[model samples]
Target: MHEQLKQQLEHAQAGDRGALARLISVLESGGSDAAILERCLRARHGGGYTVGITGAPGAGKSTLVSALLGEVLAEPGRVALLAVDPSSPLSRGALLGDRVRMQPHAGSPDVFIRSMASRGHLGGLAMATRSARRLLEACGWPLTLIETVGVGQVELDVASATDTVVVVLNPGWGDEVQANKAGLMEVADIFVINKADKAGLDATRRDLEGALASLPPERRPQVLETIATEGKGAAALWQAIRDHRAAITASGELEQRRLAQVRSELKGMMDALLANQVQRLFEGQDAHARVLAVSEGSLDIATASDQMLDLLYDQAAGRV
Candidate 1:
């Protein structure tokens, strides 16, 4: 199985599009490929920046990302896009219609666009996204843009994964309130008031300024306005992104955030694994009987919990 998986990964790394799709499928299914994905992650050398674009629906995040891609590709490096769509609960499939908006770049040799379904994940991110990003980076794609499903609050976790986070919002959309509620005002390295041609642009800018005013001078984010469809102000937005990157790098915050994200992800993985193992250990066992006894008042709840803990400890110590 490992050999077969290795061959698939090798094909993917060699730029076989079908192999790449298969590799993503394998990882998303969550078993043997999980180990393979971990190995691939460990083998990755540093690549281009990963920028996460997030905002509420109708904020023009896709248009903004497409424009930004143009700016990024002007520098002569490969760019990959991971557009995560909301999953349909009824069908358990992606509403991949958003990828249609980016279809023009599908044929660009320097650009690779993939639409990933959120797979019922609450964080507006695909469960397999990190692995997919690693795969793209390993395949020589220097830059990755992760465009998350624009469900406001859920975007925070997705933003934490990227090097620079661009929170895109449009004018008169109650964007300021949403930003504050989502805690986006805090996490955004670069805030973009997209669709600047719309009404209330100045008011939106002022609201953003007011929000920034509360933060310390050193921690305030730079804000830019863009009419993404016409490519207006894209240069300024790109420059702001670069400036944010430079600032974080100079302050050593970039490496610190990376290390912290790695640690958080590792801890989450370990906790999930432990929980799964514990669940399996109790399945079809006397644990259910103990629970029933405790519920029926024949055994105390505390005593039952203690016994379960003891059982877990014994199993960990190889006593069971």
Candidate 2:
């Protein structure tokens, strides 16, 4: 893996489009190529800032992300975007049209856009998103945008992954009452009232203002109005994001957040590894036969669970 990926990483860092795409594909493939990724990161110290764009569905998130990408691309640095869409159950691949909405810079060499499948991952993000973001950053994209699958209040793993989280809402989103209810209020560093050209815009703004009044000054997010389709408020939104970036960087919260992300990611990987071992046991013929017998009343769930645990322990002991 190291030898195969070395040239690609070098070319990717040098702004080769095909090489960059290939590197991103490798990361998205979720292969066990840790050494390759490690080498890539070693080539670049911290590169880009990531902005996580999330909110309820129908909030014009894709439109808004496209507009925001316009803002970022106007600058001189390279940009990469990941638009995560829900996966088809049969194919386990993205059922995507999100990328279609962002055709404004479709032909730009400075911009790279990729769509990823949520693959049943909760909290609106693809399971491989963090790795992909790292790859983009390593490749010298100064700004990476992640557009999530748009899950609602109950889930928000995106917050743990990015430097900033922007929550976009449309007018008439329960008039600030919904703001307090959804988990969006907590994670948002910048709040965008998209589709502001619609009716009830004033009402929504007031409600959001009222909701934000509860938080202490520094922690409260900046709320801006945007009609993303016409690109009316994207520049202001970008400035607000820049301000938030400055605040976090000046306050040392950026490093703190990255450290927290690293910890969470490491723990998640360990848990996934352990679960995979247990799952492999369940997939085996012997375990499957035993479980079938349990279902037939020849054994009990408690016995089956105990046997699984014993196998897990044996595997752990073997690793030791």
Candidate 3:
């Protein structure tokens, strides 16, 4: 399996889309094979820039992403989009709304669009998103876009994971409380008012501006308006994104952001790995006996847990 994945990685780096898709699938269903692939590709990763788009449901994020694809693809390089969707409770599969909405780019070789199931992961991203983005980077994509599964608030993880985060809102957004309540104001690198042709556009802009007034002038996110369905203002939005990237890169903030993201992702992966180990320990026969002993009052919870930890330590040390 390791050799097979290495071959797949080589082909993917050589522009084989099918191979790349297969590699992404392997990472999505993570295990030893995924770890092996990560080890193989670690040195080659970190070439691409990731931008995240997030907002509340019905904010027209998908439409805006579709419009932005045109602007991104007008350049010479390949671009990848990872559109996160809510997982189906029964099937644990992507809902596919984002993919369906992005059907226009389905046949474009220069554009790679994938819908990922959130798979019960929190903060609007699946565990595989990090791996998939790294894989795309290793395969030489210059730009990657992640459209998060925008639940109401608490989508700030995307902001941490991506280089730039664009938060979308509609015209009546001004009627709501401060954007910070939704946690959008804290994470947004750029604020986009989509569906700007609707009523209350001016009020919403004023509200957004007023809220941003407290922020340092240089740190305030640029506010752009767009009617995504008509493909209006996408160019301006793209240019704003480019400008943000340029500013961050010039100030050396881009490298700092990437380093912090790497540290955060590494910590997350460690926590996940430890959790899996603990889960396996709980599922073991020894754990079953320990549970029975505790239920029968023959053993205390603390002692049983300590015994399990000892067993785990022995296994880790190759003594079990």
Compose the digit string of candidate 3's lDDT tens values, residues 1-320. 88899999999999999999998877766668878887876632446898999877778998899999989888778889988665564564434667778988879999998777544332224457877888899999999998876634335675558899998888887433244434787778999999999999999899889989999999999999999999999999999999999999999998888888888887877777778788898898999999999999999999999999899888878998
- Name the regions of candidate 3 deviating beyond 4 angstroms: 43-46, 89-97, 118-125, 152-155, 174-182, 288-307
TM-score of each: 0.89, 0.83, 0.88
* CA shift of 128, model 2, Å: 0.6
The TM-score between candidate 3 and the true structure equals 0.88
- Please give, for residues 189-259, the per-residue lDDT of candidate 2 as tens digits: 88888999899999988988898898999888888899998998999988988988889999999989888
Colliding pairs, model 2:
none
Separate clash counts for every candidate: 0, 0, 0
- How do the candidates rank by TM-score, highest first? 1, 3, 2
Scanning candidate 2 in windows of ten residues, the lowest lDDT window is 118-127
* lDDT for model 3: 0.81
Question: Over the stretch 100-181, how does candidate 1's per-residue lDDT look in tens digits?
Answer: 6677677887788877754432222444676677677777677788887674544666676788988888887574446454
